[model samples]
Target: MPLLGLVSEYLGFFALLAAIVLVWKDSPWQKGTKVAATIGAMALLGAVLPAPPEDGAATVTAEADGKAAGGGSAAGVLAPASPTAGTTPEPSPRPRPEAADYRGMTLDDARDRAEAAGFGVDEHDASDEDKSIMMRLNWTVCFQKTGWTSSGTKTIDFGAVKNGAPCPAADGGAIPWPTMPDLVWKTWKTAHQEVAALGTVPGDHIMASTAYLNDQLPDEGEYDDWRVCVTDPAEGGDVTVDLRVTLELTHPDNGCPDPDREDGDRPDLPDRDDDGDPDYRDPFPGDRNRTSAFPNGLTGGSDDSSDGNGGGGGDHWNCPRTRWC
Candidate 1:
């Protein structure tokens, strides 16, 4: 039995004995009366004080109560169990997919495949022109890079060019810059095709001007009938789509003009002074004082007070005196 239970049992018995002794010795009564008083006091004390708990039973009961109150063991220590002790743990998410190669495929096919594999696709021009990919079907993938972004989103990038066009030698490499081709004497249509083959849009980069005098501006619809007479950047000059390239053109029937003559000269205009400049462009066509209408203040042959046409008005034909003429 526990020490506390034994001590309590002994205390109860002692209290009963003290009550008997007081009733017997302190009362001035007959022997029978004293005996009756002592017995009555004993019976009252027994009723008030409960019997001590049995040894083994008391220990077992205490342990059982401690457990019922959430104490861990017979020692009465508190349990440190968690609130979620019996529950199953949640599972982790699946891993992300890996990147794939997309070279040598059509842009449309490559995009579809990348998307199907859970990746976003971005495209770029593989040439120095930096043109946008308009028709996916018309462009083929030259190279590709696939990987995850900082946000963990799968993505792919493709460098591509028009079908049948060659790819750059390395990934993300730009196609070599093209040198201006000698398109002189070629039909406008042929010139346009050659420029396009070099990855340049003829309408955006190539311009045409009339090579003959008194001719109307050339039209794109009749480009097949016009022939190139001169190229702006000249033959073998470095060219790109961003540069403005102009071509001097004339009709096949009219034929090209002399390459050595001044740009705006008219074959019909007379040059009495034998200067390279035509009569209309020369400020002093007869005196040979000035060869062209170029504004270089007047040279020699002072103000003769006569116009080039033998008129009286002093140089009235040199209208505005600017280079526009």
Candidate 2:
């Protein structure tokens, strides 16, 4: 079969050469016609010839055929190729870094540490003051929460306070307690304002009641005309959210009743010095010396006098001795 194939290829080439020579020299055709004939013969010859193999093409094809034949099933069918074979693999995502503690560190230091560990930092005031950390170096971290966000980023939140301040007993426990103020003799509106000034919700913490028995009460909006007669958990008391402050009020028409005196006839007056003498009756109510000088108004001399005891003469009684007197 090899010998026959070689002989047939040689014959085809000789026949093409003979046809070209006959059209150009022996045949009586025009110049253009002869050239066309020669070209057709050359095209036909090229179509019949086998194409040359590319470098390593035959070797690859032969190896593929050999593999298919050897790996075929007993029924002589070749197996399907693997879907992922010879494909470039996809790269995997990088692992997230572990969370770290940032408590007890300076705000600046905590931020730096968190960023270095491939984490984002969120900071806020732990004292519940809503104060901004103007100077990071001057603030210290009191607490921290470290976890991963839904977007796959590791984040750490820090609560901080000014340096030298003690951290709260627990997280989110740094809110300062409000102190109760003196609200007696003040209008209901003024009393509510005072409570609100202490950083408390006045409506939730303050309650009012009529001071006099059988007195009809008005709506809360009319409380501006009412006066406070007494307060629960009186002045200088520490107020908290759970504690309610109750105020005894008196209507504008009915004056405040005296809790200390009976018969409800005694009038309530401002005693600046608390010396039993009301400011209206006391000549020197604001003078500490006059209000606290002698016990029971005895004839004790004034300290400012030359005698040092106001004992210069009779009936002096330490009265009209000082400039205030």
TM-score of every prediction relative to native = 0.36, 0.30
Compared with the true structure, what per-residue lDDT tens digits does model 1 show for residues 1-325?
1232245756656766776677678877889998887777666555655566898678777777868688555564444555686788785653555667777889999999999988888999877668878989988898877666768787788899877566777855666557778888998878867776766444667777777554444446866768888787788876654567777777676667787887557343356776655454466666555555444544433355765565634454454434434
RMSD of each: 17.9, 16.6
Clashes of each: 0, 2
- Assess candidate 2 and give its TM-score to the true structure: 0.30
- Which residues of candidate 2, in runs, are more than 4 Å off? 1-176, 202-204, 260-325
Each candidate: what lDDT? 0.69, 0.70
Best TM-score among the predictions, by candidate number: 1
Q: lDDT tens digits, residues 35-103, model 2?
A: 888887777677766786786677656666776789843444344555787888786754545667678
